[model samples]
Target: MPPTRPHPRLRYQILREQSPSWKTMGTIAGVIFLTTTPLIRPRGLVGRFPNLHCPSSKFSHCRTTANTATDAPPFQVSAAASSPSSAIDEEKEVTSSGNVGADDLLIVGPGVLGRLVAQKWREEHPGCQIHGQTVTADHHEELNEEGINPCLKGTKTTHKFPYVIFCAPPSRTSDYSADVRMAALNWNGEGSFLFTSSSAPYDCNNNGSCDEDTSVVPIGRNPRTDVLLKAEEVVLEFGGVVLRLAALYTSFMKVDAASLSVAILKKRLRNQILLGCDNHPLSRQEVMDLVTKSGKFSETFEAFTGTNDPLGKRLNNSKTREEIGWEPKYPSFAHFLESL
Candidate 1:
């Protein structure tokens, strides 16, 4: 009637098909895009996307910038974590504190080497206490004269020593391991325990080089070897050190030379002589010749043999030298003889 409005269906169809103005269309499109697409605001978005950067204008008024706020803390590294060798060096420094000191020594058997060690300790550390154990009563006065307190066998000691050196040879009747255990009972775990063992544990008959890490030759059924090995075990159990000495010789002990000369003398005099095959064999004429040439009642000769001897490998002391920084005063038999 008034403004004959087009039919309602026709009006709806015209509005749907008609294009809107540019500004109106742009506003409508922007509203739909914002709702559908994510609103990437710089404020909370920094935490979600840590690696991403925000525009300077977006956070210009913010107190903490995204780059400064999201920076990682500095890393801290430890000495042990950085180098394993440094850790080992520190451990060695700690363990090396067990080195021998004045007033800390106890010698089980104050024999030649024991006396030497005691003398050296006295010379180095004057007025320091050093105790020695001996089976012989006669050695008491001598040991006292040399400034060492002598302890008789089977004597009980109320004092605990920091260093114990066992120089006793393996006994014929007593258990060597028991002896070592008894001696080790004196240690308070504050210092080192050293045992003077023989290189016999390592047989050169096999013609192989041996070190501290080498496997010891089997003792088989030999009771003596078994006892020695047991003694070594007892020492090692106590965290002790074993010094496998070679054929020990000194200026005083002429056992090696005296025994040979005594054998020759008994044989030459037509006297009954008990000889072991371990002695160097010599013809009767050779013995006579030695006696005649020397013209002395007693003659001493070193057994110099060719390389044919299977037991010729020298005892290696590299472990002692490197570990304990020890060096022999007399390095060789000849040096010992020359010194004498």
Candidate 2:
């Protein structure tokens, strides 16, 4: 045999060298071990060196992330005193596209519904403060375009802008209470908190005309209803406006409508007949006439839930009209469906 070659370990060392994260970590750990070796007392002398564990190279990234996280979040922050008024001042410059009201207005809600409502208000009063809230990220661009600043979820603090509309819907049926308390919070307790409860809150039967003063009966233990009631309770206690909208209909019905196309969505009337087919709650022709055409339709028709139950005949919105000057400028159910 030739002269004895070096061991395989020596050949491996000379054959190749490679570097990766683990390799770097190992090298650092070795360096630390070398530097601290002198400080390490013998187990016998120290009684036990179990207290001095190996320095782990794996912690490099953990240490780096920990240090970096100490920095602030990525958002503009102003002191409490300057935040609200500055925002208002900034809005005044940009929101001239519409007529604002004498009293500042703030609307709390999300989705296209919120945007359209803000636009509706702007169209009505260009000077009113049209503050909007968006629960989703993708919606921010559209909201900004509408001159409606977005509120980060669970991060909005009330500024008392004279009017705060609780336009937020309850969480999906899976978990209605998930967002129920949000209504209670945005009220801010300083101004009029407009709680948009549902016409469903009124138990409408076939026999009588439901009015605002009608005593409400507990229909069921539905969380959506409970939240609306809770929100209304909270808002009303503070002298805010409680508008129990009855199938919101106006010229711009597409923006904020319960049903988009009465023709296609007529299937929804399946349950309405259970109350009583005698009452037709269609809103298409009325919606069409108000937004597109006009002056051709005649008469206001009421949508009835078709129930003879004494507890179910209380779904009228006369109070909204009597209290506020706002009126439904569209068709009654019979007039709307007749067109369809």
Candidate 3:
């Protein structure tokens, strides 16, 4: 992601440089960005490439192994030098990567979004362990002072665990491969490597309606797809799940987002007329209540790229809702504003 060649040992270098002062809240944003960039790089990549370590588990292990992708990454060191105990434990749990006993999870870049997802998994699977990685001084401090580091807690199993999650966003300045390597180093496959990429990876169709299976060939010229495209390549080397995430809105998180909508509505009211989108003006509390009450509902909205842009149309989540068994709980935008 960086314009220049990456520093290979950047992770260790960063760990040593300001790891002591990495406790302030201000560092969360920076750490989230920094650690994420390495995830954008290719392994053994120089000149703007970085490296890190991943944990081994029953579900996944990223320490190293032979890869057959066009990227041509060398066989990872972990594959050749691991103990027999490092062999995958396939009888205990089911993994997204088709593995058994996914007892460990490596979560990269812990923050608002990462926290919600990781917290969700933790709640759903009480038997699993999750470790978070951060390189920002403030985040490092927060992690360290909080005793959240796995090594210190005696949580890391030397050989195997489960899966690893790459929740970092891809950016032009990041070293995608390197971040993944760091997550994979000293590692072993646990189960699968899950990458969270943006929907930008898809080409913007003339009608602006596309899904995961859509062809990306047309998006080559689009700059937004550049980072996610590259990152997807690196993650595919591990042969795991890759999720193209949509614009996210979560209750109990980013409460300010709801307030922002309220402010916009009030401003619009001053203009004498109001028309809200089907999903608009929804507040966190109202949405939560709906889920608590009915627990299921569905809706679709017309999403346009631009107001003057004629090449736009509907973008719905019906597919995801059906696949995940989740439906929209919030109904009326008016109710959203009322609850707010």
Candidate 4:
């Protein structure tokens, strides 16, 4: 697992602004990553940390109320919000929400990863309505251009989607678990809900082997990891799936957008936890060697504080592969570079 921090938003902001060249390489590499997944049929897809919304059945004027977790913001709703005629129609729609043919997707966060999922989903299921949710309106225009109906986080609608994916980062909210629970409530349970969590919960600081069964760091030991674990619990309680992602990258790591494909491919997964990473893990020296040899990111090495840098845990997603039937196209960083 990578180092944990109190403020994940700050960390990601710095990473996003690191370099234009790096982002460009990541974008190109991401395309290659998605191509490896097996997409046999059209399934609902919801992505987050960058929510992408697709149209689904409207609410029945009576969304189920859920109890918020401790320290989470209260989730109160007015029961008499809709009129008689609308309520009856919505109730009728809700009754048949179980039908798979009309299922659509909601992506909580539509960042780079979410956008890629939306694009690919559209290619396979052109008639599907995709909706994106964001905290700000900054990217609404872009999302609209991509055929994703963008909406603000607090926006209320009559729609109840079959698939809801919470891909947003914790930095976006003070109480991550509360946000996750709210996203979970948006789903009708006719399909799957997935949360993209980090591998930081694993207690593998020694850079030892880490797998799905690896012991997790004791709760309350690290506030950052605590947030993730709590949020994951919320997802699980709601019968959603969790994907523990390792250091995600295009040029740096092989577990890029492939995880999204797996989510879409396996729609019935519930209360399951899967690890997402390549077969081979590299040390700082090895990573540097590869970059230097490729000459694609030679200048980026200055950002690393080599001698003081901590070792990242070696992640083996063998179980994830067996469980989800996923095999990464680029099984290792070496293979990813060779493709370039």
Candidate 5:
């Protein structure tokens, strides 16, 4: 007549289906058992549920003895233990290759940009050797004054540097590619070799943005562009880096008030002056007319000559900044001019 009780096995089945806390309690019990019995290996049990391995060394005793997930104890199961071996390998590689120290840099040309680079490098890395190479002996005294060791090309030297930066202009060298090859030969493939080039090789008429992956379409048979491309090819062949610079300006080249006045006076004698209108977004004729009508140039201009290259696109240095983590000290020519 009284209500009949459910079977014990049926009650357990109801509990298993209705509550998840029992499973959590089972896991906690397993962990407690594993922690208390250190001598008993849990490899067989751990091998059944491989996902339970510990994530890092901070948790559990698994950090000391666990090399594989199956060998780790129940208490040691975390996310760190389940990480792939490739991550460990990459860390080792970085540790071995990314060790650059003092006395590791050499600059091929110590001209305006080169000198600025040297000064900046010295500021970042004190007590480092910075050797500057110059073709002419005239710059020797000046280089020495700047605390840069002047080295002439083809001079015998036993010193091998880890980093080589070629700042030489293509116009100055007879064969720019040859110069780059010579610099690469000096490098034993230990560190990076960086060559400064120009963006003239790329014609950005179609696409305004030009990056490292941009295809180069030279406008015509330009010797300077050909030489720069050749040098870039040589650098790339040696797994080196090429930095294509936009127009460079420095405040140090600023003329004094007296010198500027003298220059303007001397310029009055010239019948015509060349103007680079490639940076402006107007037609040559329009720019010429604007220059002629302008009060300052009305007295001096008989005719204005403009560059053939059209201007609209800008050099996209996104790749350069992303790769080398370098940002321009002077973002624009106007900024550099204003600094003077």
Candidate 6:
């Protein structure tokens, strides 16, 4: 057998031909990594920054410390309705122990949408404890004025929150998922952790209609979407909820999607992705005309694309209404403005 053995060169060629190609090996390795690896990873830029421990007095009910850095979302949602469509993302809740208030809320990024949620929430639950987190203490006074206890982002509070709403956009941080994970870690699994996402992740084009089941652009397709999807994944992994809010208009109307999501959460629904958009999705021309008529904008209007560019996606929230018994206070943007 030894004498009949093939040459070393021949054996090498045979082995090489029989083995998998580099591409195949790479594909296998990637699959393994994605499947086994945890979505919550080591903190990126946050870990490098020093911690800014928040005082226990910041919120009389909840105690926590803060991390450095702030998140300012780069692009804004151009056309969003306060009215939101609804969807669901499913997962098991991650349980943890702490003296969390039964109706306590934590708003990570207490921006426009965040504060609105707080205001509406307070109106309903006057005694509920509400905490707001910002990158810096610059807004501490403003938040305090609104009756929300202010703290810094990445704050580790003594009492876990029943509801943790992440409203910060991805623009501010180098690592969006890490921020979400931090928020999730602060939750007590007794209530919902809601992440305000955008419709940019949806793959629909040419102003097509997007529903809860619409396919989202896969990761690696768009860097911006990757940030959001990663954050959403982190939320889902924590058995949290995600609300994909469409164009948000704060000028003449208020959106009820945030309150609707809370309604769903109170129903004890977990692991669902919901869409928040008005029942009537408007076009650019329509918006311009409306603003002009309402005297909200005096700038001269011009149409550059002339119907060439794709219209924005029409988000459908029928399921939200059917499932949660939700209806927008204003049926359409025009109706909302007209009411005033």
| TM-score for each model | 0.52, 0.47, 0.47, 0.69, 0.52, 0.67
What are the per-model C-alpha RMSD values against the true structure? Answer: 45.9, 30.7, 18.3, 12.9, 35.2, 23.1
lDDT of 4 at 309: 24
Count of backbone collisions in candidate 1: 0
lDDT of 3: 0.36
Compute the lDDT of residue 197 as modeled in candidate 6. Answer: 84
Candidate 4 CA-lDDT value: 0.56
Q: What overall lDDT goes with each candidate model?
A: 0.42, 0.35, 0.36, 0.56, 0.41, 0.56
Write the residue-wise lDDT of candidate 4 on 208-232 in tens digits. Answer: 7878888788899999899998998
Q: How many angstroms is residue 286 displaced in model 4 relative to the true structure, after the best TM-score fit?
A: 0.9
Candidate 2 whole-model C-alpha lDDT, 0 to 1? 0.35
| Candidate 5 runs further than 4 Å off | 1-102, 218-221, 250-304, 332-340
Query: Which ten-residue region of model 6 has the weakest summed lDDT?
Result: 25-34
lDDT of 6 at 226: 89
Residues 43-158, model 1: lDDT tens digits: 21111101111111000111211121112332222224322221222221111124334346778887655765665555555766788876656777777777677865545555
Q: Report the lDDT tens digits of candidate 5 across residue range 31-130.
A: 1000011122112111111111111100011112112112222121111222231122121111112334433566787775566556556655677677
Tens-place lDDT per residue, model 2, 1-340, is 2222111111000001122311111111000000011111112111110111112100011101111111322232222323232233222212223443444445556444444455555655565566665444566666666667665444434232434555666652232233333433333333344445554555444324555554444635655566566655554344444445443322213222322211111111110101011122322222222322333323332222121112223233433333332333234433333333
lDDT of 4 at 72: 34
Better of 2 and 4 by TM-score: 4
Alpha-carbon shift of residue 94 in model 5 (angstroms): 32
What's the lDDT for residue 43 in model 4? 22
Model 3, 241-301: lDDT tens per residue? Answer: 4555434332211222222222221121110111111223222223323433442323321
Over 4 Å off, model 3: 1-102, 144-161, 181-190, 205-207, 217-220, 249-313, 328-340
What is the per-residue lDDT of model 6 for residues 33-87, given as tens digits with 9 covering 90 to 100? Answer: 0111121222211111111111110001121222111222211111021111100
